[model samples]
Target: MARSSTPFSLHRLAVALVSCGLGLHAAAQSANPSDSPPSSTALPGVVVKGASEAPLSVGGFGDTPIAKLPLQASIVSAERMTDRGLISLAGLTSLDASVGDSYNSAGYVSYLKVRGFDLDNRFNYRRDGLPINAEAAISLSNKGSLEVLKGTSGIQAGTSAPGGLVNLVVKRPTLELTSVTLAVSERGTIDTAMDWSRRFSDGHGNDKAFGLRVNVEAAKLRPELRDADGNRWLLSAAGDWRVSRDTLVEAEVELSRQSQPSQPGFSLLGSTLPDAKSIDPRINLNNQSWSQPVVFEGKTASLRVTHQLNADWKLQAHGAIQRLVNDDRLAYPFGCTASDGTYYASSYCPDGTFDQYDFRSENEHRDTDALDLSAQGKLDIGGMRHDLSTGVLFSRFRSRLQGQAYNFAGTGNIWGTLPTVADPSLTGTNTDRTERSTEFYLRDAVQLSERWQGWLGLRHTRLHRESWQVNAAPGAEQPTRYSQSLTTPWLGASYAIDPQLMAYGSWGEGVQSDVAPNRAEYVNKGRALPALRSKQWEFGLKSGSRSVDWSINYFDIRQAAARDVDAGGGLVERVLDGTQHHRGIEAQADLKWTGGGVVASAMKLRARIEGSSDASLNGLKPANVPETTLKLQAHQNAFLTGLELQAGLVYEGKRMVLPDNSVAIPGWTRLDLGAKYEQNVGRQLLIWRVGVDNVTDRRAWRESPYQYGHAYLYPLANRTWRASVEWVL
Candidate 1:
């Protein structure tokens, strides 16, 4: 079926854009330029907006505070990501209740799922109010913080999975004079980061100024076991030149590279027997692995121009480019081996002795490039208190994938080890595929009244895909091109109940289109798959005192029109009329005392697939989603010395992945501790910190799918401790 429901979807999109543009013009003309001077010292709305870490910056969406965005939204600050030593996107999402193991596949690649909906990079990301869900992996560096918007984000970040959206805020040059951090952790790891900013003003009648800000971070990340050695380094620089008091130009760039060995992916099986750790732990299978030897790189650069048209109106135009490349290999056992010599295709292993009979050796390579451009501006309506903001975003993404695989069968039972294969020519084959997408969107945030706010958004997106198999028989035809298009809309509202409390609710819709046309499904039926879409609703409360703050929220999300399966074990090539939903609550609190402070957060989630006939698919707990998760922390400054004591505890409830509802797994909890001291001797500065992760040495397991449907678990990184000293100039 066609993705658009309305006969005039394209026309409607045009009208929406025109209406927002007209409203913006009115606001700009009516606003008075003398309302507030454009100066850092001015404690006006602009300064307040800039200082507060709201969800309006790049990689951020939804104005709902971290506590009230969604009962399930999880906010991980820069301090927290570093404290947990989670430097990768996958690591950041692992602990998120909304994005569990369902997206954490065996490969290091990161996928996000919120509210039971899949959120791939294609159309579900934002960076500084810019669309960044391009074809390439969005590399992040010198980030100030991160926010995960729970539920469908059609209003905040159009065309995405209902599961959620992750926004990353980059560090910007500010008036803040200085800040520094240095630390060392488990297994002799070290990290140091610094921030510097300065402003220069022209003495002429023209109020012109220039600012330079630079943030640098370097760290050596070493794994606990042998054969795992890796390092992470980042450099971020941003400079802005205010040509005139009303205009400014800015530029920034980021670079990062990572290299490491592949960890093991062991299957998790459920069984009726009490002694069974897995459904079939005894059925030992061959371990397959792959890794990027040394070269894995990602890069990004952007340029922007900001102009102030008048007191009520301002505009910004931004453009950027990004590129990413990776080369890797995979070695896996395709099936089980018999005691004698032959190979069989099943999970079971015959006889007490195991053997490796079936295997596939393969290599993979990928390259992606993307381009983005957008214009955003804010205006105030004349004679009205309404402040209107509108913008249009355009982006293009392209990707290339090429690979070859070989099979070795009948290689006698050499279980748990690599098997020797004969016949080189018959063992290998190759294939190639390419995908591209183009998206355009316009959104408006309307301040309806002093106590109420509303937002309206619309978007249009198109996707094209093609694939070919080079090793096929001469007469076989390569796949032809396939195309699809979709249009989406969003609505939201917010209200202030009192000085210390506010309540808000939003309903947003998003879509995920197929990478290619379902040729098989087309041949079997008359129509192609419709774009998958999801809807979300959320409400919450916020309250705080002079030294303490807290927030709570409740959310519900639903997804429909998803991929179904057929007899051949391949995607059914058709959309299934099914629904998936999640309901949950989230809470957080921060407190400060005369000499000490505390921070705490907790989550409770319950998700289910509402309508599916398969017993295993019906009501089965969503994979990797813990029913309860909590984190508590306390730190104190020495009353008589220059020392600090810190302690934290984390708890995770049981999680399971099963097709049948009959089998399940239990939950676990863990604790950690640390201490640090600082001192100064002459011209040098010295600081030391010592801590242990998983102090109790608990054998924690994280739900993972190294192979589709074949549950795998990642063991806790292991109990580790380290200490370090630093100096300042």
Candidate 2:
């Protein structure tokens, strides 16, 4: 069973650090000149790998060591991704205790919750600081790193979910290299990819140079669920031109497509919870023999220009554009009904019977474009030194739906025969939504005294949205529009009591765009609600050394929560009547030896609804939010001379399924194992890797979420294995 995990002693350790000598700053600044940040004109990697550990740096935050900053963040390097086969967000959940699956399904866009709140797909994702729709799976083959900023720092993103921000750093051209990989899964999945990169010098003593990097991949995926197969392919290229020693230009383009039939999860058996152990994880609950797959097509491109304004300052401008199209087709299983065709309020009936719908939504387009301009460098006035970064961003997002169809097919049983129904007519031009926003941000890292440093940032944003139900208002006079503005501020302070240990605390606020459910039971269904505001504050202590690095964090996050309630009539309306408060403490430690490394993390969270109108819901834990989680990732080199061993453990605590705390799901633990072998033949290097997921074959529900007014129980995948061969050419 799953039990909540915590590190209660962390507070005592923090107190000791404060009372003793370590209060504000952890990692010592790099002394080697080579460890300095890359020139703004040069498009180099984020981290410098050497004998000693180097802190991460990116465009938005300048060259500061993120670990020493007051904010919370995590980095997944490209090497780790390739070694661990972490191509999707689902794989990341096993290593990060605070990340959770939030109604995410196969063959569709990934959804996640950080801490205890859901992330918005439209605003919570970024491509090198510019925004992009995470509505499609980003191909990791062309990515250099993934950065998760754990709070809505207005300096990073103008407006976004309070949960977190996910940034994808695409691969940039580098030294000459070529690699090819072929991978396969035990369940008949196959994948192949090729990566090539090289720099073409001007040959005039390196006055100018052009670098190019290309990635291509294809996959035939066989999912764990029956009839839920998929196929995917991607082609991406990134280039950089060092125009001069003080100027550089970079560009990237990505085109990809994925098609897979989504598998719907199981639901409660009508007022009774089914034993998760009794159900087979591979059963087909939402598929028929003949069905089309949910298709996703994406194209994205970006360009950036950077110049050194002077010896003390740098300026950069970046622009990006993206378009995503989805064709959703499914024979989805839904609510249950009596044998005599009587309607029920929930999913499955007592006898395991439920209704099915042939849902088809096609030609859904999401388009986004953004431009960013910033200057960051050292500044001095009178007798104070400041690391100041100022920027402005303009962005627009548009969503259009061209066709949709949702009609009842017939009755079906989980353990019996399923009915087949004819296709329904498709409607046209159903929805059109556009969002435009502009933001100006400023951040100043001040050197206050020798031991005390502070970071103060602010962002002012103006947003306008227009939504139209074209079907309901054909040839109408105008679309419903709303305009709003918000100014968010961020503050942080760090005291470097010593070089190895630092104490830091930060407070920030963010905004989220919430929408009422599209269900017909409510009066204001399918309407946009007002902007929701969220607040978060945390304090932490961290220490870094040659052999080890560790941090302990405590956070309190509060957000306005939406709920469905009876509005006196028979129908229910969605309302924001309460607040969701989450308080948690997390600890992480990383140790690296000569031939091995280990990462261990744990989170203890108490998330509940407060000040609710419904007495039953007050102080109740929200659905799908786990109380505790534990994760460990480890790798050992030289296990047998040129062989490496890898392992991971994930433990999730018990979680509630209903808002009223009427039902709950047990917690579970899973282990993963893998190995890698490397060999050098003549002039080429070859690597072989094999891994097994869910090695224990535990049968348990991974998540129980109430989405769109319905309950879904997503089961954990059974034991599966994968093997791959990589050749460095």
Candidate 3:
């Protein structure tokens, strides 16, 4: 683990500052009743000054809650994130429906999934308004908050997979100073974080706006899956300056480093093991564990810029570059050896043959480059108003995997010694694949009258993919593959039932054509690439007041051209004329009690997957999706004398592992409790907090890493305890 070189913990300070700032700001702003503008209520939902674009919320897609999106959307907040003791991005999928977790082939390193969709794809990720994905696993682990939008959101998120997209919102610096937290848990785990934010802006003085935020975090965890362990160190900073009153520029940057040792598999996909209490020797959990014999490391660096143009118009540009290095080789373990000289029940490879497996040793890396520019503004014409937003996005995603394989002819042990391996000349299987996607889109929300509203959106996307494979042998001609193109459309409508409620519906089409001249296209000869689209129906009531807020929604979503493989082992996933229906009900309510000091928030959700026979996924239980889910929370801070107290609870329903419909899992419930106290030390002050997680030690299985047949449950952490103390400066 890299040692922290920073002066203090930034994360702790940032969180405390941001939380307090927002809370106090809201209170202060509400108290000043005379500071109301022309459109007071409308501006509340439009805190993101300058312009409104697409009616899509940056915190989550659309104005609805995660559970109320036209499709199922689940949101995990930063506060819940830390309280749940999440260690990696995979941890966020625990309560989500149809989302799975995987420990990737490299081991220890994990990835998340929703309905078997490759959500880690770059296009599916977004921070604020910027889009990105982790080329390496480390980036996924350090995220602060995540919102998983289930089903196709191509109309809003642009070109991408059809299953779902996880939009991770990173933590930012705030105007708070001095915050700290420390924790120790089972498995010799330890973590510490600190954050501090200082504002030079003058709301109390000369009005010269300036602020700086710094965050630092580090942790060490020994996972239960295997003998492997991981360590991470992170540092991030942000600064903002106001150029006069109409223009402002803010720059943000982050750096992180992570390293972990090799470990065995913790989850399984399909296993023939018997369901006995204490039986089945062949069902060993580590039977399929593949180890990487070398150590691994990953690093990331990013910079973002935001500028405000005017109160109703603004232009922003953002660019980021990243490099990923995996310095290790996969080694087949001896434990996987079968007594009869066979590996598992799969006949793909006999006892110790090389061609049957993709095991190899080598260095692999990927470079990511992205630049996105967009403008958003609002135009109000008398009683008629137009909330318009437009933007262009360009991204380059590239990866290179070059390594050596042993025992090509199945004749040698091919151990530590570097063997001649394959004729490296034939470019057996090494390539640099680069994909670039450019998109231009515009969306306008037109309010024609007091009760009627309409939205029009259009997006044109062009995807170009290129790959070059070079062989190590002399005169080996390298191979290159390239392809380009796709377009999408969107529309929506809403009707106001009263001052506090509204009902709306939307329809959109998303497209993704294979941009490469792969075997599928070459074999079919320009017959066109695979494409998928979604037709969605939604209706809901949104209404609320200062003391109570609530919303309810019902929706049906159908997808076309879903991907599915054929018996010939070919890309048989074609555009089948089939419809898969996902219908659900969701509602959220928050009540403020105890003299406006205590608040109670609760959410209920239920979802299902119904597929048509024509889609080849007829009865398959929509992979990694849960059939039902529910959550309830109650948070309150009461001041009695000089101390404050707080408490909360969370629950999750049962989930499924695969789309095969062969297995079912039970539900799990977890509880969290915490409290804080504060006092004065001369002119300075001190605040203390303590909390406990998983008070029940429930044996919960995380649906992620569902590949292996093991009971792949993400067991609740054994009653973790934490304590923190901060000084208000």
Top-lDDT structure, candidate number: 2
Cα-lDDT of candidate 2: 0.79
> What is the per-residue lDDT of model 2 for residues 226-319, given as tens digits with 9 covering 90 to 100?
7778899999999999988899999999999998888787888887778878888887666665567889899999999999989989999999
Alpha-carbon shift of residue 638 in model 2 (angstroms)? 4.3
lDDT of 3 by residue, 338-405 (tens): 44564442211232222212255456777767777777777888767887777887878788777455
Candidate 3 weakest ten by summed lDDT? 46-55
Candidate 1 vs 2: which has more TM-score: 2
Candidate 2 similarity to native, TM-score:
0.91
- Scored by CA lDDT, what does every candidate get? 0.54, 0.79, 0.51
Clashes of each: 16, 7, 29
Residue pairs with backbone atoms closer than 3 Å in model 2 (clashes): 2-667, 23-503, 24-495, 24-502, 24-503, 25-495, 25-502
For candidate 1, the per-residue lDDT at 61 reads 29
Query: Where does candidate 2 stray beyond 4 Å?
Result: 1-59, 340-342, 415-417, 427-429, 473-478, 515-530, 570-574
